[model samples]
Target: MTKKSETGSTKSETKSKSEIRNWAPINEIANDVRAGKITALSNVEKSIGLIEKHSEFDAIISVLDEPAKKRAKQIDARVNNGEKAGRLAGVPFIAKDNFLVFGGETTAASNILKGFEAPYQATVINKLEAEGAICIAKANLDAFAHGSSTENSDFFVTKNPIDKTRVPGGSSGGSAAATALSLAPFSLGTDTGGSIRQPASFCNVVGFKPTYGLVSRSGVVAMASSLDVIGPITKSTEDAALIMDVIAGKDKLDMTMIDRDILAYTKFNNNLTGVKIGVEKEYMDEKVDKEVKQIISVAIEKLKNAGALVAEVSLPSSKLGLPAYYIISLAELSSNLSRYDGQRFGYSYPDAKNLDESYMLSRDIGFGDEAKRRIMIGTYVLSSGYYDAYYKKAQIVRTKIINESREAFSKFDFLIGPTTPTAAFKIGEKSQDPLQMYLSDLLTVSANLDGGPAISIPAGFAGSLPVGLHIMAPQGEDRKLLGIANGFEELSK
Candidate 1:
């Protein structure tokens, strides 16, 4: 059934499953592309082919076919001409739909923003493309990155690659699922309250959330501005580290942007000897599933055996993480979502009697339930009457959580815990109960609340489901955190 081409190579030979899978790491692929061993066009096609093959997973929102192919050809030309190819030459990756990307409508999985095109690419996308990484598609996410499950998306819910019947953790579920399925070697996701790490945990990949402002958030869709931090979901810590090296830096566009570490992120020190790690009591509470607790405990024991100094640590304010995060996030979200008021870009009311009616109807019809709920709660908290009692108090609690985390770091190098209370839950399991849905972030929100770096890595499994070992370090210690996670990844093996 195979036909030989003019070059005497069968068409199928060019489409080998391994080539389509892109199993090589970033460095290997980049080196090969630069050396002309593999054409950039072929790399792009491989990623696109794999994405099409796994279309049923609902992981992608839109594919940048023409753009990606065009970029690939340009990169191929550069390498063919003996030019200096960038570090990520010919690598194809995915970005969460929430990100503002060129060549596709950055819907953010919400009807309000449906069909809206980005005026320009996100800073992260710009940086990646500068190094020859092509974003082949925009992955799905919860509507406006609002929910714990992709079930809240205005589009179809993204299926968990491991268990289609189950939910992929959200609002970065699509990115995680895509990364898990190898639709791309890696993908980008924004974490405001475990959006990145939770899904990464569920899908059994490495998800890293850098310290706040470490990566420029310019051009990304606004979520809770204070809490939002974008990171990667990839197969290994090394890949994430290599990516961090490229994307981690200050940008004039984002006022909050900070300078990156002087040391290259790719230089990971795997030695855990004498490293002090604290096991948070609250994160490993009795409420955590027995299987998950055991798996996490075993992972911790691996660290101890590898010469890490392990000890019990408590942060009572950790209990306030969830509540504080929700309040501040919602308040910020309310202010951010206010931009979609029918007049600007995105969906506007087609039938409206007047401006006021247009504003009301557009938002009412455009936003999903979860988005509306957050907007309402945020508005309520920021309202004059409740601002002092709710928003102000929440900010105070946030400071306390940050202080407690800093205090812990003063004594310990990193704090560890289970990324979630349980593994991937069945779709619609907790969607009906907001409280239960919120509980899913119980263990992962403090890092965001305090602007500390955090990462989730695979820790064996709880039954058949993957459990993530959540790791946290003090603010601005993202490089060290990546090093620690990489060490654990090696130690666990």
Candidate 2:
């Protein structure tokens, strides 16, 4: 069934949302479409052509060709009839594989869910559609979103858009690559730990993780209930802000969602004058690559010259964030993955004669190696006797990190660091070393632990690979974080 468009606005009915034409990517296409300068069908056609053109990148899993074309036609009809369209009218975007979106299977890149079609749409997807954004494709991700690289995807690893030899950062790797490849103006991604920001860093795009509970999580697959944040992978900060303005409001479907700020996120203050930024000293330690360090330092120096007060600050508990995140997220992952037994909507083992055998066989045959690894680890930590030793201790570490983050924010408006310790590594380089792979998120997981907002903007490259300048702000300060990020776009890149 075709998903319905939520609005039929005329030219005069369209609100003066923002002067989106000034933004080069997402809104430019939307403005032109509403003004009748270009048909929605024409943009959809171009986007389809690009998807086919870059099929080898493995960035996208399923293309919603028929439904997207149908929706585009509908938008063009409304525009032709002089009816108003929404803010993102006629714009196309991609969603990460795990989101429960219509038009294709919501597989999460794992065989266990290979044939799962969404019975309902994710809140973010619905919100975007209501604003007239069309989802043209589903992007690949680590199966069950269990790894730091798309290599964990049961089907195939997504290649970095800029350099096919390297891996796009996971588990939002495919979404990041799709945006960078220009398959769409923006794409949706989930950040638990650093899935969204790490990939965006590697692919030279912008990734924004809202303060926890700022965006509703309804209909999106849960990796870790407390940690998951739905966000956009976009070409620019302004475009991200525009998308957030539509999707950031509270939803009764998600009890955790908070009320969005009344001030429009689109009206961001990009002026950096007098902004106090804390450079994360821990992030610039010996383990960080010299070249990557240089890139981050250059960005800090640039900000300092722009009248921003910058100083080195420490969040030492952040050093333990990675280990804490793994224990917490995996425990939640194991619990969440429990519902995917053979009796449900996805793949089920046909040969099993007994109920217990069916459950054992289905999961054994269905989950990928990384998925199984996480499941075992998650279960191990949450087991009878080990719960206090592992899970409880991790939560203690998480709390310490949160307190440190709060203290850091009391003195500084935002924290700056390298999104990743290094630029994108070769596709197979860290695959065998789970420890190394887990380390990719060392710098980003702190924000999630703190339950605050964070973003990754393209910084200079480390050789051929693109790196991002990671920034963070305290809880409930998402709007200010977004504004500060918008200010550094030109200087960082």
Candidate 3:
């Protein structure tokens, strides 16, 4: 059994442990808190200690020290009063900096928005708080969610927790690293184009990107309006499902949100007797790492052994998904990022001659190189002469990808592949070459392009580095996707 110190004081007062390997799951922590085996304050202190010890990863951009402690005390009081706490009560979790939480700045890991405090809580934050989950800190990400790697973050690049020299994928890099290192039980991350799933794959954790419009994006910093979805990265699929239950619902604030019956995603814990799993031949080709492909092959065999029919399915349009996604995402980003023009909020450059100069100087200094590249690409694509050739053509291609995915799903319940072409690469491995970095997301971007639900679960390791099995289902099939992942998790275990 896991043990805790008895002194019941701040993290500074406790004796430190060196292993850095002992930590309990969220459900186990909650059970201990409720049964008085440990106090919530002690748990929060330990989490704070872990964060401080692993500061090199730069996973936490800001820690809500006082507010988190106060919230933990309130939860303990409620338990003492004999009140029923919600499912995730007294659990500690982190929210990516893109989320607007009350106690800390939602910088989105950009200098342009540094120290900008939110007046209102994000809907997902509010929902988790209602369930007694404490928002301990804000995790780092690619600034404005613009890049495939967290190197685009203005503050710092998040290192992969498994191997300190490698990167944890992004824009959800910090969230995945935090959970991987057990800094928090789970963390909320936003996925636009393979952000959540890819990072989770690198960190060997469970990352769930729900169906588009299933989770409210009311207060999330918008990257690509059509592709952004808030999801959870956790140690286990069941925990991911638990976090989803709290945050999934219709919100009047986000008009794109739909009112659908939210099912208990945990109920997906069953054998995969009748499930049909499809392996995309395009994703299994020679372009992917041999070991990563082997891991996925093993997962497919496990599913087949569990009585699920497995077959290779063709998604010819998937090859065009990355280019199409970049075009669409940049077009949307170009428009969304226009709001940061020094007037209303965010940072403004000094010594500007006029409005135009201020806008130009501020943005030039504020955005990183990769961000500027995308902005320029977006401007060029949306420009009058090239609009039809680039932007419009990408949209037409996107439509084709979506239609092809729908058709494939009509025959197979879920599509499976390697979540990423390889495991976590070195931190500076592909930073200088933007196109090489973009190709890192080749296998994971199709689901985002099609606006479907997808997940990445740890399948096995390629040597010491972990690989993830990618599973995707049609839009509005969040429950089914989780169920299928749960089935795979059980079989793999």
Candidate 4:
């Protein structure tokens, strides 16, 4: 286990001054607050200050300073009264713009829903609030969560905290950037393919994508329903586990949720002596950058050092994951996005001659170029004659991908890989090339295709950029996967 330190120690005494109190884990922050060392209101103010200081990243789309302060006061009052607040009492967190929260607009970083107000909070938001966690801000994301980089966001692109010129991987770029810069203790992000993990890797934070049905998706804006998942991005694996414990469970509003015994995920951080980790041969191929491969090799060595057996494995079908994911996701996107047709909600063109014209005009004007491209591609793939050839065939390919992953896991406790080919690319590097943007997710799409749980943890640094190593498990094996990650985390440190 990683060594624990006393709260509020001076930077000079800590092993690394830069790692002192800035990105302290949620549990440590909670302990200090409960012990009267730090006030909830003070923490909120600190976060506000950090947000202001790092405005260049454009990570926060909107800050709910007033409401967050009021909530912090309430938490302090409850603590003073000696009443139990909950697991995350007084902890501040941000949610990706796609999650509906009360204090500000949930824009999804898209012009179409730029000023849209949500009538209710997402189930995850409500659950977190019940645990006394404050929503301090809404983080930016790719417009409507449609792109691999936040550059597609109609509002603004979030820059990497480590290097301002490099992109903070997306569509969860803002969430990852916010967590990395200590703008918030933790943030919630959505993943369809590699949205959460890739950005988390790029920003050098812990990002988790729970099993497809493990978390409720009731109030999150629909992207691709089959592959979409809501998860946490935080500074440490344990913090991610803590957030998951609070937000995960079966929800009646989401029928896809399955009934399972809830466990404190952090309790699984015991030794992973008997775990079997599969190192995919395809992931270590020549296509991967040398530095990224070195990072993954180091992480695998850490796992092996922690007493886990490491073995070479193959998922030949994984090569088709990106294409299959795009074909299937676009088909779903075309259907889910049809709801913003100028009549029900979102921006509407005022000068249209008729309803159809209004719908077409508004969409054409509101959506960014990347969004339009995906929609058009989706429309083409789902058209009558091509649906069977592209969409249907992709679904079949998806089944093969899922089967291969499942069979591979039968002999292994988890699968490991380089979260991305390298590190964060420069903003606009791949935005113009649709194929290049799609390939960025080559390493992450298979987990979504198989509907399993996966996490990206900072392995180490490559040059100045960060590299993330992914650990994945079969669906519903979240606790085991988290346990193995926690163990590896200890070894790496």
Candidate 5:
């Protein structure tokens, strides 16, 4: 039940089950909080209450009950005092566990750092919190964001909110699942090689991966540093855009941050006149499931009906993206993971006799199977004899992919494709075959390799599950891409 003040006036009425289930978008809640129609405290209580109700999904790693309540009360006091509570005032959200957040551990779903507390907060988190958005919990992810299926998480597999038996799309699976189940209006996830968009597709929510360097990565856990970009998974493309305004910009800590004039993305233009969209030729291949293909085809037709000029385009280098992405990503991952040697950071082995043995035993006991496999593959590729053959070759291939993507963007305003080849698969379905699991990201990784912006929106459903329509735009065209995605998202409805 919603609470009232001692003055005998109701603070706010409780939201209906349908409204809560559908999740009132960010703007709606923020407006209510600002207008005093709803107290920030009430919003926090409701969010925490709903998360408890849906606890069976195992989507969250830890809850920030005390801090969230304290923040909400602070926001409520500001509102009562006739002060602005910031743009996102009183909107409760979730951060992927990989982000360094205070008041809780930043485990990244790995046992090696299970008890490690973050000394500070991620830039994105501080930005969101500054705008009065409350982070009530941390969502789970693959250990070190290494695997595509969240099953590699050292803690526990995050269940897809749609189908408990099916796997949520990973490395950002928990964030996507939390958004899908309406645990929050929006959630943060890091996209490196389709981590955000894939899970967004599986969960039938909107997931956006901005152009690399658009969002600052300061204070976030390193995972393939060059490939990692932070983005949002929200109930609507508009919500994602609203969040972009707060978090997207140059940061002093991350030298790679870009300075560009970004438009107000929430104000979408429905007119698609003169807009040319390319349908990636390879995305229509028979490898995609029949139902997923049909759904994507229908979504493309919606854009066409809205006066978008749709045509087929070929990017021959697209097929090489997945393998090249894995090589480059694993290589970077090996270097990033090398810091956890049990000398002064992460989990330490108590029974080791010597320093070398300590390094060996600590990593073996701390990292999960998927993480170990990637490390081994990475170490081998970057080895002295093989470095020139594999690591250097992968970089050359990456440049080719980026150049091809840029050339395509010269002719087309955006590229259209299916986010995933299929819907959420049953848990343990592809766990034994790592290769099969890797194929799940085949359609969504190119954007990451090319450092472009991409978004996944609910298109249509196959059977009881939903499919996503993936859209891509050239690097630094994030605002334009979000506008196109929002327009297409509206067309689907």
Candidate 6:
């Protein structure tokens, strides 16, 4: 089908309104809003409609209807007054519940934070709002962002939009599910391991994980201080780039963020001539689903045909990447979570007999099994007797993984792989086996362990489920990674 373009010309508008309403490109929506073809209020209304229409997915924790309506009116008023409303003008978006946004609670999908309202907004949310974007909802995730599937969420399990019976990958599952269902053009998600990319793969959206510290983490509920990175989940790589422009920068509050060149990610050229790409051997383990592997193989062929050189490389240290990631992440999680002792903030037990009982009762009643498991694991690893054997050793292995990744980057511009070993599995399929659940992040944890950037783009389908081609680059090379991903995305189309 052909639709009228902004230039009064006809262009292939293959996706129907029903198909694209929730997942439309950022530029397309922004252009229409600027041209007065659509009002910000109408866009927000449509997003609200979709959120209600797909309520069964359990992808959202809360909707900001009142605030969203007010914000849209303000944007429309600005547009009518002949004032500029910033780049993202009227786009509607959702932030993972972990982000501290006004109009709703920031629970991180955990019960311990049941009624904790954020005093201020997260840095990323403020940046996006500055660009005229409206956040209309808060998406669900695993409690404290601990699990690989939304099943670990204290509230509800976020069902996959593609197949409702299957799990939407997590701990960022709700963000990916919302994007897939077109509830928003783009959604903010945090990736500590494969949290963003794995879910994007399952939902067939563009999930971007910037180099550690590229986006400020201030006001976000900390999971793993070192591994936690803020990023976006969008319908297209271009949308991801557009979002990166607004959110990728250093903030005084987050001193870990580094100053770097600002990239006009939307103006990328899709030429891969003479570019060298590496297929990480560790990520292609025999455990990967056969159908998913085949889809990735075809994607590599497309890149090769685009004038890129492909080679097989070994990152042997990556085999230990998962263990190291879990250890480090849990250790950080334990320390970060200690502040939630029920007395200061978050959920508190009213029937507690004493102060110690209050702390024990609140945490015991609030934390889900998964959260408890992780907290226990984290405490054990950080304990005096096991610190050297577990936590310290994991850190050493993490360093080795980073060094090995750097060595590979010297030979190739980026590393490519399947984002997840398999497509979305049936809900509760792996919930009983924590080891099996952890394996879902096998191919993705190395990038986090190395503190590098990675992206997941839709490669193709594995039967009815979608597979993602994972592309990763060295730390601070996010622009290069996105440019290459844009080329691959264009090629896939």
TM-score for candidate 6, residues paired by index: 0.95
Q: What is every candidate's alpha-carbon RMSD to the true fold? A: 6.3, 7.8, 5.2, 3.7, 6.3, 4.5
Clash count list over all predictions: 0, 4, 0, 0, 0, 1
Give the higher-lDDT candidate: 1 or 4: 1
Candidate 6's C-alpha lDDT? 0.88
Write candidate 5's Cα lDDT for 1-493 as tens digits: 0111122321111221133355577888899999999988888888898789888889999999999999999999999999989889999999999999989899999999899899888999999999999999999998999777799899999988767788889989999988887888899999999999999988878899998998899988888988999999988888999998889988888898877555665655656767999999998898899988988888888898888999999999889999998999999999999998888878999999999999999999999898899999999999999998999999999999999989999999999999999999999999999989999999998998988899998886776676889999998888888888878777765
The TM-score of candidate 5 is: 0.95
Which regions of candidate 5 are displaced past 4 Å? Answer: 1-22
lDDT comparison, 1 vs 5, better candidate: 1
Can you write out model 1's per-residue Cα lDDT over 283-380, one digit (the tens) per residue?
88887999899989888899999999999999989999899999999999999999999898888999899999999999999998888999999999
Model 5 error, position 43 (Å) = 1.0
Q: What is the C-alpha lDDT of each candidate?
A: 0.89, 0.87, 0.85, 0.87, 0.87, 0.88
Q: What are the models' TM-scores?
A: 0.95, 0.94, 0.94, 0.95, 0.95, 0.95
RMSD of 5: 6.3
Question: lDDT by residue for model 2 over 412-459, one digit each (tens)?
Answer: 999998999998899899999888899888899988888899999987
Global CA lDDT computed for model 1:
0.89
Where in model 2 is the C-alpha error above 4 Å?
1-24
- Indicate the TM-score of model 3: 0.94
The best candidate in terms of lDDT: 1
Per-residue lDDT over 1-493 for candidate 3, one digit per residue giving the tens place of the 0 to 100 score = 1112232422321221222244576777788778767777777887888899889888889999999999999988988887866667788889999999998799999988997999888999988988878999999999998777799899899988767788899989999988887797889999998999999998878999988898999888988898899999987777887788788999988999866555576666456888888899999998899988988888888899899999999999899999998998898888888888877788889899999999999988877787788888888899999999999999999999999999999999999999999889998999989899999889888888887889999887776677899999998888788888887887766
The per-residue C-alpha lDDT of model 4 at residue 201 equals 91
